[model samples]
Target chain A: MSTLKIEDYDRLRSKLPNRTGGWVPGTAVYCRGYDMMDDLVGRVDFFQSLVLNITGQLPEERFAKWLHAAHICVSWPDPRIWCNQIGAYAAMARATVNAASSFGNLAADSVMYGQGTLPIGTRLIQRLHTQHLNEKKSVEEIVDQEIERKGGKVNIMGFARPLASGDERVVAMRRTAKNLAYQDGAHMQLALAIEELLYNRYSETMNFTGYLCAFMSDLGYSAEQVHRIFALIVVNGVTASFSEEAEKPVDSFLPLRCEDIEYTGPAKRALPDMTDE
Target chain B: MVNRSVKSRKEPFVKKASTNIWQEQPVEHNPYLVEKTHLRGYDFDELTQHCDFTEMFYLLFLGELPNRNQKQLLQLLLVTFISPSPRHPASRSAMSLGGGKTFPQHILPASLGIAGGEYLGGRQVQLCMQLIQDNHQIIPALWLEEQEARLAEADKALLAEGRIIYGFGQQYGEIDPYASLLADKFLGKSFSGPHLTWCAGLVEELKPYCIGWLQTGIVAAVLCDLGFPPHAGAGLFQLIQAPGLLAHGLEAYPKSRTEFPFVRDEDYDIVDT
Candidate 1:
């Protein structure tokens, strides 16, 4: 009789449909010498376990190593970086390390320049590549159309970072990828071609986002997974920055004089008519 | 023949609408290095130095600084309602996250996310605010009867689906003391807005149904008095409660790695249901 029919009960369930067997709790705990201990603790390393937990399969050793390198490349412990600054601010305010870590992690998850960019770039790369390969469109056509769509401000997600001639991180990540002998797949090749076209027209260099896009795509991770993993991987660096900054006096990390602020607003006006609405 | 997909978009109608309430500072550079907060372009330094937090809070919500009465009233409301008890689930989450040293970034957003659920810190206020707004100019006594009647028709439909009505009653059988204390204080205040009075009038009417006005109702009424949209209450409540979450998180900092109590297999008796 209701809009939600009896048959819809199974459809509304949050549980994974394919996994019909053992219970994988939201936060699984493993105790030494306890049942189901060896399955999580003794058999798999942390990264391997993380992959297994997220993707339902442990990646090969080479892929795990590559992932480790990719994690390290973004883990700059500079409190000056956007996401890390929250942690630093928390620390300086004499906030808890957990508070600092959690808030900093949140910064990566929400703000566009942090973990938000990874999924965005991944989606863009996949879309553009699909348009190029399957849709049989020229790179120029797609790039031009995208620029027009985004009001000509360059919608190419993985290139042309602000306030830099070029990122050194991309070079370092590529070097690490080479060291791991990680072959560039069709996605990466497509990204490189797009990058070349962008550079020729707009002087847009392939920033770390481009490399990250390629790396995540090569690992066969979906955009959402890439986003989550990006946050998980880079949070340690943000935590490090928070710990570093929290050592100083409250609000002392980058000491600011009151006069440094440019007051562009009106002078203080007195509030009128108290004791009545 | 080639089939090409054309680009599709919803007709351009405010592409990005975060609203006048809050916006990220447009500066692309190191935002913390210089001032980034634009509270209606209020000088952040001066605002902190001269104006009380209520004035700033008013600007945050209304996009304009408040008058003296508005400021003082808002301050009282904040004092009355913005209590983040340790027992609150959001605070509990913050404590757990902090205890585990999860990292600085996850604490506020994560805790606030916990706060923004169907029950607890969010939905009661949201529902109260909406009901109050929808029945804005109604005679409160009569309106209360109408509400009770309307729900009476739908009550069986709700109970069948395990849905308890929000904006009234307490988890415990009795009325919440916090709600009563704030109500006393609210009654004592000289500036009694119609919304506040309207919500107060509904309490007696609702009592026979094992429901009494909770903190969520009064807070919603006060916010409606202050001219915020009903929808903004939950998010604003979360924001106000953030410092309390931070405090809990900070308290948890020195503790050892303690995951929030997970259900152990042994703890549950798996007798046939």
Candidate 2:
């Protein structure tokens, strides 16, 4: 068998249906592992399925077991989890700004900055900086001052006291800030901006799972071995409503978009037949 | 600050239309996402003990474990943003019904309604919700066909002549980088199988329509997996994007940008000369 090259992988990847754009607007593209398996295992194991489709070789049982076990075991107690989530949200927010900044007719700069900064700023100030405020002053007064300091216009609509207290006010302020972040007539533009932000942030982290699968391949496993590992992980790692149905083992690995399987050691005989252009 | 009243503008023809086009169509619940709540050996409070509220949001909404902080935040933010407003226009509209509204039932539909339009504050959230719903039933191919037909008709009529399509295209005029970025973030993380499959199915079906516009469709599908209602997805969008708009509006406000009264410019012809 011919060894698979990155170029071959890329060529095949290009053939798969690209559906990344259809995600709901404003959703950060962060799929929980359990969720993905629960959704796709019947058709295929996400990692192995992706690998098999990409590399045309099914993984061996032992390799599948090891990979699945490793994924589940390593998945525990990740410290970066929280940071990744907040970072994704921040990234999505930034994407929104990027989308609007590209518009020609609008006052793109001011609109982007004002709308982009205030909601996040309010969140940061409330979550991080509120503790430093004058103790004597009420939370509402602090928020009002902050709004003034930031040169933001405050039109207290219904609840005034809620706006005065920092904690309570942050809630109302953030909501109001979100509402005011757009120009009066730019709904479609703003929607696109938010959607773009969500898409960018989501895509950035989605490849990591594929990367993890590749890591297993680099550890001296063949394509079939990798597929089984993914299947094992899907079978064991995930919790579902219908465990009995989901627990059933599959005959073949389901193909995924990113599959990187490599043989161990140097001078690995590349599969000439498999290397079809 | 310019004195602008926060009161709802009562337009002459703004009566609520009774014909609910979406409601008329009976939506079959995707069995993957929704199910009868059975007592899985684990106690609810005990499960709560091991997880944070944010993680719980992941469990409840997307029906899986929380993979990253941003996912948790997105869920929290949605709940935070979409929580029924006690004094919103809809809430005020509801007051005519009687006393204070209850939980899920009262707020759910009302929130869904609020998320549906342009003038209303929750358009992005509504769009997000609808996109989620759409991803489940309509694969990408069909969706694109529908979108193309709409865009074609709109384009032919010169309706969207200069304007960007509502969910298509971007300001950079390039493929949206964010869509792929987020999808990468979410690819391996676990989620509801049916929902994710439904999303994948959407990606497959919509592939043809999104050849050049692939990023938009992918991002829409990912959001759907995140459990946003297809219709209200846009409203959630507005919440996430509130910052950009706020920045622009505030900056422009200082320069009296908001002061420009709406005027009919006859020179602004629909068909460019």
Candidate 3:
């Protein structure tokens, strides 16, 4: 394998045209919508290559396949709740099957809000809405009255809108999305998928994991799929850097290069660095 | 302690319900709150360090610490992803709306389009970043003043065009209570430099304009502190609305084979003529 030195990485990044109209390399790609996959043809398994290229670590075939499936599935359908879009549903189903085949844990609990609680909550809220209308009270007035009656803080206002006329479909959708956002592994995959989707849709980029859940939920993707996809992406993308010279370029240099590389390790590493404090 | 307080407050709501319907219903849980006991034999000490906001952000979603290279890659990814694009679809949407001509109608869609396009969590962060970069201590004041001024300008433009103000009246009959709390959270404590003073001034200037919309004041103040730039405010709004969107998405997902049937609406009829 052609090892990429730190200097080489730096040179490539610096030489790349600033397509994003900003000084930042990443911003350039984001603004220009430069599809990385297209540039690296015959590398359809971009996720695997990305793991290797960026971290110098290769993933197992099974792991790579699972990751790819998750990626494609999560990436297919952009989340739109009110519109009831279903293009991504097939992808999600395929991802679930791939995950089950690759990982023994197929029936992992969804990270979203408990499926059991959503229906009742929505129904109850709907009932309250109806009661308010019956009493000739506005949605806000009813919520306030209820808060007062319940002696609650009433701090978070505007929860009494009758936006979903007790429609079982809408209620169910809301519940599933909420649950998916909170689900583990699945949430991760979903987040990654959304990240890709957003990049594709908006032609803007952002931190991958930081806003994964936020992005998935915001774009109207299936939260359950997001949770699962996030988990798979994080696990599949894991890599290690055996060198300590990583910080030298980013901190002091104007830009990083491949020649500056000096890390070597087979030691396993995680996806996020969590030792700041 | 905070959790306990919140739980105690919710007890009444739980009790008031005639039955345990709420408990029986599916409830979404925070994934981060993992059960310590379930993590047996896992060497958490071996995990990588999470040092900065970016690192913490990754851990929060990915559930594991990243190594040096991974961290760098993630950073590169973020820098590539988060920055605004000049020719973004949202920007196009905004441009098509005709700046200042349509006012709220134009601005809201444009902002939403920008936000939706970028997937930004909130415009507040972008605004805060801008203020901090421009003039630290005066950020708050400047933010308040600018927002109010923009709002007034928008309102005036709307009036001239014979259109009603957007996001002005309370749709739910009351102001958003969280607005003040959020403002205090973002700026009330963390801000102390020249930006803080500026924010105070802006608040004073804006108070008159926010006659009935008290929440606007809080939103402006908080967004200022959060580092969002004026152009990015609409994006921030979209970002904050992510949770709501996610909730809707999850609810729509089919839980089982049986749930799929619910998706079929029986109301529609096809004409074969």
Candidate 4:
């Protein structure tokens, strides 16, 4: 016998939807729990409303401004960046804008450049901070324990840029945060302490990602929340990359050659005898 | 501590009532702290230690962890649809992204986002699932008049909705053998499911119309057998295929970025405006 009763199932037919507190459907208008169309139609800027939607609360005006800093810093349109390259390829291939943005944003999850490491690092750092306060552990002791916990991979999260020796974006971001009076939170201090310790040991410097995570940690955003927030912040970079490609002629940006591609895999082989030869 | 579940959920749909697939601890601001996943009622903490990734994948979509057999079957399903040929539109999207020597991050969103078409990415299998759910008694048993009538209704409804049948045919009337083989092998092992059995019966019915069951049919059958709701089907396919998409995207990353794919395919005809 079938588990579903046709009568009951028919009465209950509907699409499963993820719930959200940020936006509520209010007939013809949408509500952000504040005001309806009047508040959003032209009153608020896109970035500010976005942050408000993300955290379920509005951030300080300056912090909303600081959110754009990462975009400005990381918005490299060079086809080498994964997100940009996808956009360029779509433009080159005469694919749609939808293809460029979807693929470009998806690329942000790659472990090296995007959302991959930040959340993991944020979680560990948050946990250690909790441990430090609750158990009264020193920074040095906490770093040592964290290093051991991560199996001795000493370069901790919210610190170090593998590509650039001195990440100038850090100075700019810090200044912006300071200007906004959102400075010297415990998470930021801990990040700096960790940065200092790592510098003493491995000479690695903290980059903009590290700073961004530190701010989120200080604001009580959990690792999972950081993942959502980070996606929001870096999407500007994704789009900036996308726009650069879409504007150019198809394949006009860094062209590729088929002949240069070396095949290291097994050469052409015959199919098994299961097929009638 | 034994992780206790607080809620139980089987249906992923909500027609007239409020339905949620994820639930958490009563405490605000500490969802994962004492979280309660709706389907299995597993404490969030316990899931981390006890659940393998394949089990986790099931839990995320179907809202409950799979048993050993279910897990193994799902693992195979995953291995099968994980990627498509590079010639596929989705793969073509990823390859195009890589042509610019871009980061690996950008390929998936483009490839998977708009992957909906006649083949593995289509809504055809989903429509078929709808058909089976609606007319289970008639479809599998060769109830010709009723099945045709029901299919005609569906065809009209689908036409009104501006959609086409996709799962059964990748294109107008073609099905890939590799996909068929994978589905066949999976069906061989996990035979207890009613949905799969019913789908087999439906295949016989479709033969007169010259319709062959495609990979999407196999996927729909397996998913239905596993008790997954209809909405989870397409998202699950994409999740399984993400890695394959990522791999192709990365492969194109280091190659020369100046190459024009469509441009090289055929030179554009210059005409006066």
Scored by DockQ, the top model is 1
Candidate 2 lDDT over B181-249, as tens digits, reads 544444455443344455445444533333122233333444555655565355444444333333332
Q: Interface RMSD for each candidate model? A: 13.5, 30.2, 30.8, 30.0
Q: Score the docking of each candidate (DockQ).
A: 0.05, 0.01, 0.02, 0.02
Q: Of the pair 1 and 2, which is ahead by lDDT? A: 1
Tell me the lDDT of model 4 at A85: 73
Q: Report residue A272 deviation for candidate 4 (angstroms).
A: 5.3
Candidate 1 lDDT tens digits, B1-273? 111112223345432323344323434565544344545565455567666678777876686777766776788887765657787888889998888887766777888878766555665577768888988688766876766766677654332221344565554435566766767787647666788887777776666664566666777788888888878988877776788888888888777764445445443322221
Write model 1 residue lDDT over A44-134, tens digit each, in one string. Answer: 5667656665666656777777677777877789886777888788888877777777668767764346676888889888888788889
Residue A27, model 1: lDDT of 40
Candidate 2 local Cα displacement, residue B133, angstroms: 1.9
Per-residue error for B117 in candidate 3, Å, reads 7.6
TM-score, first chain, each model: 0.83, 0.20, 0.19, 0.81
Sequence-dependent TM-score of model 4: 0.50
Model 3: per-residue Cα lDDT over A125-170, one tens digit each: 3344345446655544654565577577422111211222112322
| lDDT tens readout by residue for model 3, B175-224 | 33443343344343323333334544543453444422223233333344
Clashes of each: 18, 137, 110, 21
Candidate 3's docking class is incorrect
lDDT of each: 0.68, 0.34, 0.34, 0.62
Task: Tell me the lDDT of model 4 at B94.
Answer: 84
Residues A1-277 of candidate 4 have per-residue lDDT tens digits of 1233456555433422222222333432343455546666577666567766666666666766777776676656566666777767776776666666666666776557677666876887788778778998988998888688779886566666554444677777787888878767897887788777767776666666777777888988788777876673445555566677677776557543322222222322332232221
Q: Which ten residues in a row have the lowest lDDT in candidate 3 chain A?
A: A236-245
Tens digits of per-residue lDDT for model 4, B220-239: 77777777776667766666
Task: Please state what fraction of the native interface contacts candidate 2 reproduces.
Answer: 0.00
